[model samples]
Target: MKALVVYESMFGNTQQIAQAVAAGLGKHVEVEVTEVGLAPDEISAELDLLVVGAPTHAFGMSRASTRADAVKQAPGGTIVSTGRGVREWLEAVHPGGVGTMVAAFDTRVRAPLPGSAAHKVAKALQRLSFPEVSDPETFWVKDSTGPLKDGELERAERWGADLGLLVNSR
Candidate 1:
């Protein structure tokens, strides 16, 4: 099976998780990982699974304002500006012919929040009639510009592997 793992990260924590997840998924199937800005405008018909991830901002997906705030918070202007984020990409993409095996994930503070980017992304995909293979998943970060919570990368990899197994069983 083929899979695509796309992500948006402000401080790079989410990107790390995305990479780990792709690594895990790669063990089971051919996978391609890309940043949201570089992702294809349409999901290829040959794909079996589509996984998306982003950093949670203000309880949900990051908007222009939130992204600007994140860039300002970074020390020494370390974060480079990536014009388009997952939110924008999701809003613009045509999900009509996308695969049904969709999954979403997000990186956020450990606090129990009412919303997450992952959840939002999953809902958006569902609106286009994509069947989710699993519930939205959250990976914790220590702070806004974070080193992810210890072991989260490993956990992400395991999650991807499990998802791959799930896809295979279908």
Candidate 2:
């Protein structure tokens, strides 16, 4: 089985979690990690699973205006996902998922936010005909530009491993 982990990050926290998740997935199947800017626009039949993730902005997935706002607040002026966000990538991806297992995840501050990037992504993927393989996941961050809450990376890795195992089993 092969899995692609695609992600968008404003600061570095989401990317770090994506890498950790990929590392865990690599243990159970062939896995590739890429930023949403460079992610493929089509999912081929050969790809067995797709994992999409992004940092929640203003509640849900980042929009152009939200992304611009994030860029302005980027720590050290270092924006990890300067080019594209998961929203744009999803918009442009081909509508097909006949044999593909899909999952969504997000990074956000541990607050009572009203929306979720993962949920939005999952809904979009479902609209594209992808069968969800798992419930949407959320990894907590400390602040806007975050140092992810302690052990969040480890938790994400475990979640990835479990996801990989689930797909491999099926």
Candidate 3:
């Protein structure tokens, strides 16, 4: 099986998780991981699984304004000013069909929050009729600019492995 893991990260925590998740999926299938800005405009028909992740901003997906604000606040992170984030990417992608299994994940502060970029991405995928292979998952961060809470990368890898199993079962 072929799997793609696309992610948007500001401070690199989410990028790390995306890499770890791809590593896990690699155990069961060929996988490619890319930043959301560099992701293709459409999901390839040959892909069996599509995993998308991002850093949660303002309790949800980060918008251009939010990302800009984050840059202003943090001053020195790899925040992309000219690239499309996962939210914009998701909005623009037209998946071929419902055959591709989809999963979503996000990095967020470990708070009792009501929103997540992962959940919103999952909802968008659902609207496009893609079957969800896993529920939206959250990897915790300690703060806005974060070193992910310890062990979160391990957890993300495990989630990816589980998602691979789910896809293989189909």
Q: For residues 1-170, could you state the per-residue lDDT of candidate 3 as single tens digits?
A: 99999999887888999999998999888999999889998887888999999888887889988988877766554564248898898889998755998999999987776789999989988988888999999999988888899999899889889888888889
**Which consecutive 10 residues in model 1 have the weakest lDDT in total?**
91-100
Prediction-by-prediction clash tally:
0, 0, 0
TM-score of each: 0.95, 0.97, 0.94
> Over the stretch 61-156, how does candidate 2's per-residue lDDT look in tens digits?
999999888878876767989897999999999844487989999999887658899999999999998989999999999888889999999999
Model 3 steric clash total: 0
As a TM-score, model 2 comes out at: 0.97
In model 3, the runs with Cα more than 4 Å from the true position are: 75-77, 80-82
Which regions in candidate 2 have their CA more than 4 angstroms from the true location?
Answer: 95-97
Q: What tens digits encode model 1's per-residue C-alpha lDDT throughout 47-121? A: 889999998888889899998898789886565337798888887776636555899999999776677899899
User: Which regions of candidate 1 are displaced past 4 Å?
Assistant: 96-98
Give all candidates' CA lDDT scores: 0.87, 0.91, 0.87
lDDT winner, 1 or 2: 2
Question: Of models 2 and 3, which has the larger lDDT?
Answer: 2
